[model samples]
Target chain A: MALSASTLKVGDTYEEQVVEDLKRTQLVQYAGASGDYNPVHTDEVFVTKVAGYPTVFAHGMLSMGMTGKMLTNYVGDGRLTQYGVRFTRQVWPGDSLTAKATVKAIRQEEGGHIVDLDVSTVNQDGVEVVSGYASARVDP
Target chain B: MMLEIDPKAKQGVQLGPVTVTAEDIQSFAEAMGDLNPLYTDVEAARAAGYPDVIAPPMFCMRMRGGRMLPEVPLPSGFMSLNAGQEIEFHDEIIAGQTYTITSRVADVYEKTGRSGPMEIIVRESTFTDAEGRTIVTIRERQIVRSPEKKI
Candidate 1:
């Protein structure tokens, strides 16, 4: 069902805590699924030996997808007109994350009602891993 | 012999014609650990007014299902990371539909920040549905730097 605009205030918020902390194979699975085979994401030995990193880190899109989950949980899939994020920090294994989207504005646009949101994801350290915004059409 | 990429590798390239399937949508949602019914159950979607179950907003990122070339090639022994992303959703994507996406290296430059010398490549991708309707536009910034180049 379309979101009930009458009930969502400008400051209303929706949040989700990821069920899994960081998985070891997520990057490789994502690499296979997304086809972003950048070795920095999948090949740990390449990173540790050549590029020099402790181990494989989470893909920014993985975290963004998690944040997208948070939004979809609240607004449902296919509801967003625009959603974006800037990678702020790298996410390592064992780091827990929380994604949040808070309603920022509500207005009318041609064909539907538009709702703007301020979005963010933070890690266990409370450091922002990614931050951005989204605008969606909430059919009334 | 490593990853010394040619900067031209990513110029005005066509990325995909990946067909969206129920399995594709499901795996992505599972990877994201998001079981939102709108992306999982067709009946649930029908109950919610959609003709079929749809993909999440971020699903487009994985729509590039093949080897996508980079606009600016990086030297081996260097690592790259996503700096940021900007996306505009123009339309909804439903399962069993196919979407073609084209991408180009929009910009390549170097910046010395709190970190150090870093090469930044900006890439733009546009996703269009089978009927030629625009679905989404994505802009990505990738930061490449030598592992030793730190503050």
Candidate 2:
């Protein structure tokens, strides 16, 4: 069901698990899909030797996309007006990721009921990888 | 502080006229660990009223050329990071469609942080159908800085 301002409370929380024991090929798949051939995300040797990273890591966009899934699954695809995030930390392989979306506020704006969200993605160790805000028009 | 790399008014810097295929859509959905039929199954999509299998919302990240921003010239010794992003979906990007993308440097500014100093570059990329209808607009922020000195 679509969440609306009437039904949405300020402190309501939503959570989704995006990945578990994340894989290396998933990054390859993401690289193939996104056309981001940045070696830091794909080549372990390049990352270790050239880029100085310990190993190949997940794209920040991957975490951001998984976080977006939490929103799309709840609000339905194509209903989000704005979704954004800040890349706070590197997401390495083997990290389990969970996206947390909390209702920050509800407002009636421009004749539409909008939901404000405090969104974040955290790894298994509870390290915040990405955090930011997202807003969407909700059903009433 | 003055920006090292100044911003410009770019009407549209063509990045892609890439085609989106069903495979492209499915691969991205799979990578995100999403099992949504609308992004994968044709029959389910048709039942859901989409003309064909649709793409996930963040599939826009997969659209080619959105990553071309960091190629811009910046101050030497600066390491760039994907700091933040703001995306607005104007139209549902469907599979098997061709869209062109263009991006421009919107702003550049410096901020002093705990790590010392950094430059933030802002960019706006637009995706449009061949007919030029709006598809999506992505505003991304990139942060650049020198490697932190180990004490």
Candidate 3:
């Protein structure tokens, strides 16, 4: 069900563990699905030797995708109008992530009511990995 | 400058008119670990008033075809990292429909942070369907960082 704007209010929050112990294989899967075969995300040897990173890391878009699951679940299917994020830090394998969305506003638009949300995803250590905003249509 | 880019980097490159498929939608949602039926089950999607299964909101990011960043030459020991992204969705990407993507280098600039000087390249990509209606627009930021810079 879509969130009802009648009861929605600013400062209301929802959170979910988007991923736990993020895996390299999942990165490979994302590469195949997204057609973003950047070696830095899936090739450990290249990322460590050539890219000079500790090991393969998750794609920023992957984190955004997972975080998006949380958003869609909160608002409802096909309700999002806009979703944007800044990749704050590198997400490494084995890092669990928790995504949270806090209601910023509930207002009326030309078509109907909408909810504005402040989105944030943080690693297990509480280091934020993705920060951004999303807007979605809501039920009146 | 930490890096050098081709003065005439290609922009507004038309990427694809690939048809969206149920397999593509399913794989993408699986990779992201989202089992939402609206993206996987056509019957469920139809119940929701969609013609077919719909791609997740961020699925438009995949339309880039591994061309998310400008093909600039990084200086020795410099690496590129994703800095941020902004996406606006005009409509849901429905399965069985063909879509084309056009990407352009919107801007390039330099900024110095606590670590050191870095260059940020902003790329904007638009996804449109067969009807020539816009589906989504994304602005992505990629940061070129020098080797000495520590995160």
Best by DockQ: 3
Better of 1 and 2 by lDDT: 2
Using TM-score as the yardstick, the better of models 2 and 3 is 3
Candidate 2, residues A1-140: lDDT per residue as tens digits?
A: 57777888987989988899999989998888788776778998977875576898888888898898888887776678788898888899999989988999888888888898999899999999999888888987
Give per-residue CA lDDT, model 3, range A27-117, as digits (tens).
9999999998778898888878776779988988999999999999999887899999988888999999999999999999996999999
What's the C-alpha lDDT at position A109 in model 1?
89
- Per model, kept true contacts as a fraction are 0.73, 0.72, 0.83
Off by over 4 Å in 2: B1-11, B64-66, B74-78, B146-151
Q: Estimate each model's TM-score.
A: 0.87, 0.88, 0.93
lDDT of 1 by residue, B1-151 (tens): 2234455555567755777887888888777777788788999878977777888887888785433345455676566777878899888788878888888777778788777678777788889988888899988877777768631
lDDT of 1 by residue, A19-135 (tens): 457887776777776767877677889868876678777888888988887876777556788888988887887789998999999988886788899998999888998899998
Q: After superposition, how far is residue B76 of candidate 1 from its true place, in Å?
A: 3.7
DockQ of 3: 0.75
Question: Model 1 Cα displacement at B62 (Å)?
Answer: 0.8
Residue B94, candidate 3: C-alpha displacement in angstroms: 0.8
Ordered by lDDT, highest first, the candidates read: 3, 2, 1
Local lDDT at B82 for model 3: 76
